[model samples]
Target: MTELHIRAATPEDLDTVLAFWKVAAEGTSISDDSGGVERLVARDPEALILAERGGELAGTVIAGFDGWRCHLYRLAVHPDHRRQGIASALLAAAEERFVRLGGRRADAMVLTRNETAHQAWGAAGYGPEEQWRRWVKPLTDQVCSAARPDCSG
Candidate 1:
């Protein structure tokens, strides 16, 4: 069995994390915006978790917390690292970290068409919940702008 080290991600790990998410199953939108990750890193570096084997990244999971509940996202394992417990270890570590941060209850969103992911999540103690619909609006021509200040200027 290949030994693995699971730990919170650092800004230096974004490239590796992006590479891992590149091979994720279809319909999964996991962190396409590097700028977003940069912001997330600034807010909470520990939310990103990774598994390393032989000093190489083997798996990754982005875990976020909002005090009441913790959220899991962008879980991926190197094809060569699958079945080696790297993903599981990363997940367990993420959950433990969430608990350490005083979070209760964890949640994750998987694409509806991802049957393989469904099975894995089920095996990991997640169950089928009510159907969820997703909505997205294209911001192709729009730029993210800060809310206007109400102060009289």
Candidate 2:
């Protein structure tokens, strides 16, 4: 087992990270594109953390702290790199970042059907807040506005 190195991602890593998500991540996100990720890196460079082993991207976690709350997203470990403590390492790093940022509690967005992810997140001491439900509304994009009459702006 090679030593794993964890570091914040840079602009040069945006394309590779996007491609890696397609292969390693469980699901897609609205902000998965190059532009969205580039904006994230531009806004907060240390939010996207990457784990590398032997020069290959083994895992990634987005540890975002927005003043008031800490959010974890896109925790993906490559299939070939599973069971190698990469996820744990990534979570530890994320937690440390949150603590540094004065965050009280950290929350993660895990898909309902991803049982494997459930197990991994549970193992990391994060449990689902079943009492609360998530509600989301996508801000209108140009195509959406053109297609839907209700889409304002």
> lDDT of each model, Cα atoms only?
0.72, 0.90
The whole-model C-alpha lDDT of candidate 2 against the native structure comes to 0.90
Q: Which sections of candidate 1 miss by over 4 Å?
A: 24-30, 131-153
Give all TM-scores, in the order shown.
0.81, 0.92
Residues 1-153, candidate 1: write the lDDT tens digits. 557888878888777666666674233342355776777888997888878889988888878997878988777787777777776787798889888999888888776667877877887888766775545553554332234221111
Clashing pairs in 2: none
Q: 54 in model 1: Cα distance from truth in Å?
A: 0.9
The lowest-lDDT stretch of 10 consecutive residues in candidate 1 is: 144-153
User: Per-residue lDDT for 117-148 in model 2, tens only?
Assistant: 99999999999998998776676453323344
Model 2 TM-score on a 0 to 1 scale:
0.92
Candidate 1 residue 43 C-alpha distance from true site, Å: 0.5
